[model samples]
Target: MKFSVFQLSRRGARARNEDRIGYCYTREACLLVLADGMGGHAAGDVAAQIALNSVCALFQARATPLLDDAPGFLAEALLHAHRQILRHAQQHHLADAPRTTLVVALLQQGQAWWIHCGDSRLYLARAGALLARTRDHSFRAMAERSGQPPASVNRNLLFTCLGSPSLPISDQAGPWPLARGDRLLLCSDGLWDALGETELLALLAHDPVSLCVPRLVDRALQHTGASSDNVSAIALEWEMPGAQSAPDSISTDALEGDAFESTLQLDAPDLPEPAPPVPALPEDELSEAAIERTIAEINAAIRRPGERRR
Candidate 1:
C-alpha cells in the first residue's frame, strides 16, 4: 500500500496561536495526529506540543515496526501523552491546567484504526460519501443525543479532554478496512466545523494531499472569515499495487464493497481563506508572569459553562 500525508497550522485571528500542533507519520503504516491546546496564553500551545510530542515519541519507542498491536500502541501513546501534559503543568507554576483534543489514525495491513478525545474528528470517505466518523466528547453531542433542541447544544463546550487529571482519559479505537481509492481525513474542529463531508470528498476526489489539503484549508478559511479558529488538515489516499506506473496516475473507481454508497454529505458550510500570520513572540518576550495570567484565564474559562463553545 502507498500513502501521502501533509500538515499545516496557522494562528487564525487570535493574538496568540493557542491552537497547538499537528503531525503525520507512516512507518510500516500511517499515523496522523492533531492536537488543539486549551490553556491560556501560549500554555495551550505548550500543552498541545507536549501531548503530540509525547504521543509520537511513545509510539515510536513502543510500537513494533509492522504494528501488529496498533490499537494497544495507540492507547498507550494517548495515556503517555496525558501523563506528560500533567507533568508539564505541575513542573511549571502555570495558573491554569492545560488540556487538549487528540485525534489519531493508524493504517496497517489494509485496515485502519482511529482514536480520539474531545472534538477533533476523523472521517473516512469512499466514492464521494462518508463511511464513518468519530463523535465528539462535548456537551453538544450529549445534548443532541438526549433530544435537546439543536440550538441548545452549544458546540464550544467540551465534556471531557486530555490533560485534566480529574476526568478519565478517553481511550477509544476501531478498525477501518481499506481498499484501493479510499480517502481518510483527520482534522481539527476549526476545519470540520466550517466544511462538510461533501466539500471534503469533492476536494479530495482527484488530488493528492499537496493539492487537496490547501484547497480544503482555503475553502474553510474563505467560509469562516477572520473569526475562524486555527485550521489543520491531513488527507490520506490509498493506492493499490501496480497502480503507480506513471508519474501521475488516476485509477478506476472500484467499489470496495456495498458497505457504503456515494450519496452521503455532511450539512455544513464552506471554509474561508486563511488569515494573515500572527507574529511569533520572541523567546524572551514570553515571561513567566504572562504565562501565569494566561493559564489563570484559561483555567477560569474551562471551569465556566461556555468556554468550549468557541
Candidate 2:
C-alpha cells in the first residue's frame, strides 16, 4: 500500500501538551492512533502516552504482517490499554486514575477499520465530501443526536473514557473500501472543537496530508488563541502513487514480511516507562461467565454517582 501521511501537535496555551498521536505500519497494515488526555485528572499526558505505547506495542507484536482479525484486535487492544492505565494508577497510588480519549484506525488489504472511546475522532473524506466521522461520547453529543434537551449539558464532559472506574464504552466501524485519494484523519477534540466541519473538509480534500495537517493545526491554534487546548492531528491519503507524491508519501511494498515501522514516541523524562505489551487472553481467561461478570461490574460502576458528571 502507498499513502501520504502527516501529524502535528501544539501545546497551545496549556502548560504542557497532554495530547498524543502516532502511526505504525507493517508490510500489509497501518495503525493510526491519537489520544487526548483529560485535563481533569492528574498525569493526563502520562495517560495519553501509555495509551499510545500500549496499543502500538500490541500492534507491533500482533501484526507480523497483518492482523488476523482487525476489528477484534481493536476491541481487545482498547481494553488492554484501559487496563494498563488502571495499572499505572495502582502502581503510583494515585488519588484518581488518569483518563484519556482514544481513537484508532487500522488500514489493511484495501480497507479501513476503526475504534474510539470518548471525544477524539476519525474523519473519512472523499472527493471533497465528508464520507464519515466518529460521533463524540459526550452527553451534549448524545443529547443532540437523541433529540433530548441539552440544557446545562457541558460540552467537554464525556460519559466514558479509558482509566475511569467503569469499563470504557467504545464504537467500532469499517471494513470500508478505500478508493484512491481517500483521506482519513484521526485527531484530538482540540482541533475539531476549534474548526468547523466545512473548514476541515475543504483543507483535507484539496491538499496532501503533510500540508493539510499543518494548516489545520495552525488554524485551530489561531482560532482559540491564548486559551487553545492542546491541538493534535494525524492524517493520511490513501494510495497516492509515488509519481504524484509529496514528501510524506510512504510505500510499504518493499518491506520484509517481519518488518515494522512506527512514529510513536515516549519522550517525557518525568513519567515512568510504559509496562510490557499485554498478551492475548487465553480462552479460559475469557470465558462467557467471566465476560458477563465483568459487564455486571461495569453496569454497577456506571450507575453509581460521581463527584461530577463526566
Cα lDDT, all candidates: 0.62, 0.81
Model 2, position 211: C-alpha lDDT score: 86
TM-score of each candidate structure, all chains considered together: 0.75, 0.84
lDDT of candidate 1 at residue 307, scale 0 to 100: 18
lDDT of 2 by residue, 1-310 (tens): 8988887777888888898777878879999989999999999988897788677767766787789999999998899889889988999999899999999999999999999999999999999799889999999999999898787699999999999999999999999999889999998888999999999899888868888898998999899999899888989999844446555678988987657666653322222222222233233454434433433333343334433210
Off by over 4 Å in 1: 20-27, 39-42, 168-171, 245-310
The pairs that clash in candidate 2 are 158-310
Residue-by-residue lDDT tens digits, candidate 1, 1-310: 4655555555555555555443323234556677877643346766676666565544433333356588887887777678777777778966656888888787767789988888888888887778888888888888888898758667878877788767534646567788777888877788888887677678867666668777888888888997888777767787765666324332223422111111000111321221111122233444434433433433343234421110
On TM-score, the leading prediction is 2
